[model samples]
Target: MSEKVANTFDGRLIFLMLSILLNVFFNALTVSTNMGSAVWTASAVNLAHLFNLSLGNTLFLEGVIVAIVNLILLGQFDYFRLFRNLIFIVPYSYLLAWFKQLFFAMGIPFLPIGWRFVLDLVGLTGVAVAVSLYQRANVVLHPNDDLPFILRFRFLHGSPCWSQWDSNIPPIAIIVVTAILTHQLFAVNIGTILNFVMQGYIIGWADQHIFPQLHHHLDFKSTLH
Candidate 1:
């Protein structure tokens, strides 16, 4: 292979490795938050179960309806991009299920209702850190990452300010909104607006701090030319 091509390949591999490591860390944090979310989902399911409703029926019907609505509103490209975020889903899902079952087996009590909010904040901070670092690396984005890009690019196509907000807003919004909605839907409250504020600042700070370091270390400009 040509020397230039070989170097390009090597650089990409390094970026991918970094991205994966960051993703793993992010997923680990998500499992923590998802534990609370799962409780919320379970509570919702249990409520349905109490009413003699089929679990499968709720999942199949609600899941499809939500998916269709999201697809129609978000567009095909954005909708399909959501699957890319699934990279961490399998492992996180397994870990969450196992943890939940283990807690149940041991007869552990649910987190004090107040503590669930703390867990949500902690999880959001972890996610922001992971995402900011990965994005600075400029590797291929995971499925979740694409959502912000698509939204920003589509709606704020002409605004420089929107461009800046585009990258940061989606991740923060997703984390905060998802946490809030999970609790609201299931009668479980986790965290407050402060969690979102702290996470967003941390992520923005990390992105600013890390990208410059990467540009210097990786000689990004030189590589591009």
Candidate 2:
């Protein structure tokens, strides 16, 4: 690549990698707060419980499955993308384990139920921003989000009778309903509801405002293609 092209490529790589790390970091923080509901976390929780496996292992397995599906659907599963997902997902799972252990070791002391609920909302804000940044980075998305994107790509992006709103419903319904069912297997909380309802607006706002400004600031004019 030309020097200028290489610079842009390096910058995009930095941005995408940083975004993924932040997503995992903030996700850990949200889970530590004992009030938040994330679909992936809930899914991990259920999976771990079902198989009596560690949450970290469950996350890794889920990531593996999701990565393959994403690659197949996007038809861009070159070695680089596969390797990229591999390195990112593997450490991400282990880091999750470490963070959760640290938090628990610090003593997840009792908070009032009300306080826990508030923390969930506070943590949700972090979760929203992290997810928004990662989505805008246009990198390999977490499986949890990628599935929804694939659904929209397949169903909503093409159908004439279905408007954006109509296309929007199914993916949201699929993930959220799956979360609810999984949580019911072992959890019930308003935090999950908050995650379900608030995400669309957050993502919309980020795409319109945060993403454009960020891309402009970074001068990100290229994709990884």
Q: Cα lDDT of model 1 overall?
A: 0.42
Q: How far is candidate 2 from the true structure (C-alpha RMSD, Å)?
A: 5.8
The collision pairs in model 1 are: 84-143, 85-143, 117-191
Winner by lDDT: 2
Tens-place lDDT digits, model 1, residues 74-96: 65645333343343334333443
> TM-scores, in order shown?
0.45, 0.71
lDDT of each: 0.42, 0.58
Error of 2 at 98 (Å): 1.9
Tens digits of per-residue lDDT for model 2 on 126-207? 6666655655554555655555555554646622222223423433444455556555443225665676666656655665
TM value for model 2: 0.71
Candidate 2's displacement at residue 2, Å, is 21
**Using alpha carbons, what is the TM-score of model 1?**
0.45
